[model samples]
Target: MTTCVITSHGGDFFGNDRHLTKLLTGLADYARGCLPADEREPLVKLLAAQQQTEVGTEQTIPAADAGQFAAQLRRIARHRYLRSTKLAEAATLLANAADRAAADGQPWTWRTEAA
Candidate 1:
């Protein structure tokens, strides 16, 4: 019997931080009126609160419609808007908050694909 596992080695690892940042940044894009005639008050509030937080300090990520935010993220990523370095930085910030909120307050770590 023979088995094979395939994976790419060079493409950058789009880990949780990257994904969350993409989502938050994308949410920010749509929340700013890129979306249709709709109000994004909750999202805007959430963004505002996140923006006020300082790195290496307590973060306050407001609770909002995660499903909606994720959907918007997919839309933005599909349109290739998540490719900007600015958005990537924003994602890192958002992800930092998530890590702080995670159980045990542990920072996310990368694992080998082959492991």
Candidate 2:
């Protein structure tokens, strides 16, 4: 009965502007809505830290860095959102995408290529 939504960073490339922050904000809001009040703050902090890393003042996050950030965010969400299987599924998808992109020498940006 629990619903989870993972936002996509919609753009031509990964780590474009504050896309990660927007996604994390969305996730945190969803967690607040679904999780009990006691559990929301930790999730919020996790998302906030992630946002900061994504939008670090001095350095821009590269594709690999973004992938790692996504992986960590997935872990945090899985731990916090126990009843949400979709979060795990989303995590797997993100991990797989990251792996495939690395293997193919492509950026983490989403692309549709014929198999």
- Residues 13-113 of candidate 1 have per-residue lDDT tens digits of 53333223223434566456543446556555555433333332323332233435434434433444456665545434443433333433333232111
Off by over 4 Å in 2: 1-62, 77-80, 111-115
RMSD of each: 13.1, 10.4
What residue pairs are clashing in model 2? none
Clashes (backbone N, CA, C under 3 Å), per candidate, total: 1, 0
Per-residue C-alpha lDDT of model 2 across residues 1-115, encoded as one tens digit per residue: 2212222343226522222344545556655655556645654564444443422133223456556545554554566544555544544455455444444445554322111
Q: What is the lDDT of candidate 2?
A: 0.45
Q: Single out the weakest 10-residue window by summed lDDT for candidate 1.
A: 1-10
The superposed Cα distance between candidate 1 and the true structure at residue 47, in angstroms, equals 2.2
